[model samples]
Target: MLFRQLEYLVALARERHFARAAQACRVSQPALSEALRKLEDELGVLLVRRGRAYEGLTPEGERIVRWAQRILADRDALRDEVDALRTGLSGRLRIGSVPTASGAVPLLTGPFCTAHPLAAVELSTDLRADELLRQVRDFEINAGLSYLPEQGTEGVRTVPLYEERYVLLTGPADGLAGQPHATWTEASRLPLCLLHPGMQGRRVLDGVFAGLGLAPAPRVETDSVGSLFAHVRTGHWASVVPYAWLHVFGVPPGMRAVPLVEPVHSTPIGLVTAAREPGSVMARALREVARRTDLAGVLGALPKA
Candidate 1:
């Protein structure tokens, strides 16, 4: 019946614990429970499967949760619109990005902030491509920086940004050193540190290796790019990573990067948002920023590794 009640219910469903949910809502446990009970009474349906402990929501509650998400999103969109009109656009722009594209997001957000100084931005890089698409569609994130899904995705809009190419990172004494470029086959034979297979970058690299009929067994696998760099700094390990990352992270003191060849493959990365009409003002602003971003110029400014 009320926005606060809906917020309480949504928070409870997400946390799945009465005490924790209450903590999240910044209210007492008893107050949150009473609010949910009141919401159920007003709606004339049993929403939660109540017990001594926290139980899951009922089927109808699940439906209501979906509606609550949309309603809350619309409410925020309205607020953003009014705020933009009153002064200037000012709200948090939540962005989900895949690990590989994480470095390049600043290229878009930098100019965006200069244009709309009042706006706030939050970027999360741990999400995979599929998670980014799902979150964008579910209104969990305003937009995402990810590769276009191979089979294509539904209920989403995409703004093409740039192609993601890869390079091999190694120390001067490494096996592949002194080469202008290294092939997948050539790189696979070395002691490599790579992202986990669950990550989009790793999957793409796996696909390339599979296509080449090669299997690369990495000496070290991790989720952090920083870790990969750290290991490669030992002068005994190497990694194959995005070309943009080489420019973004800057080749470490002892490390050098060489382009990947023997068939250079590039994947397209872009800004993805929900396809729903009347998108949030922040989402629209990001799309406009993406349109005006001179990706080539930005890339050219970085020292080539």
Candidate 2:
């Protein structure tokens, strides 16, 4: 019945371990367990199916946990609202982003912090789309920067920030370097270095090649964009990456970025927040910053999709 009890229940649901949840809540395991037991007794419903180890939540428990998350989020928002009225907009804003969209975080965070000087911002990068959505739903992040999958998200609100265009990067000495555009079919014939398939960027690139009925057999695969650039610097390999990444991984000397056309591909990248009504002040502030920034303009300027 108590907010503290609901909090404990939610933490347990998220961590799936009583001891870890207790540690997260800064309470002893016994106290946490007692609180949950009291909550279940008061509600007259078994909120958790406990065993020697942390099993999964029951259907009723899952429902309760969802309610708990909303309650806790609203409570936190109320506190933030009251605090902002007294002290101006101020609280930590957490953001999750994929590697390709990492550059855009600063564009949003820099101006947001300037507008709300008391606010703090934390940015974590390289999360996949599903992970990003899960974090937003769990209130682990205030906003996320990720590709808007064509299928669309269920319980999230999104605003298209930019359309990311893929470009071919290679040393100037490479035969295809000076070319203003390269086709997927042409790029496929080269010794390429690429991001690992697990990344959303790689998946998009795979689709582009697949559309051409060509499967690019990369000479090397790496998880880091910096590594991809480094490999291309060796003058032996080429990489296909989003244009936004050019600034983050700084095109190595002697490298040229050629637009990929003749079936050019682009993916819409956007900012996402939970679909819940009455979002937190931090989330609202981020949305405001996103609105003011040149995200759409920057992306729109890229060569044809």
Computed on alpha carbons, the lDDT of every model, listed in order, comes to 0.87, 0.84
- For candidate 1, lDDT tens digit of each residue in 1-305? 49999898888887899999999999999999999999999999999998889889999999998788778878888999999999999989999999888888999899899999999999998888888887887788899999988666787899988888888888898767788778889998889999998988899999999999999899889998778889989888989988777667787688888888978998999899888779788999999999999775565342554
Name the candidate that leads on lDDT: 1
Cα lDDT, model 2, residue 187: 88
lDDT of 1: 0.87
lDDT of 1 at 96: 92
**All candidates' TM-scores?**
0.94, 0.92
Model 2 residue runs over 4 Å out of place are 299-305
Worst 10 residues of 1 by lDDT: 296-305
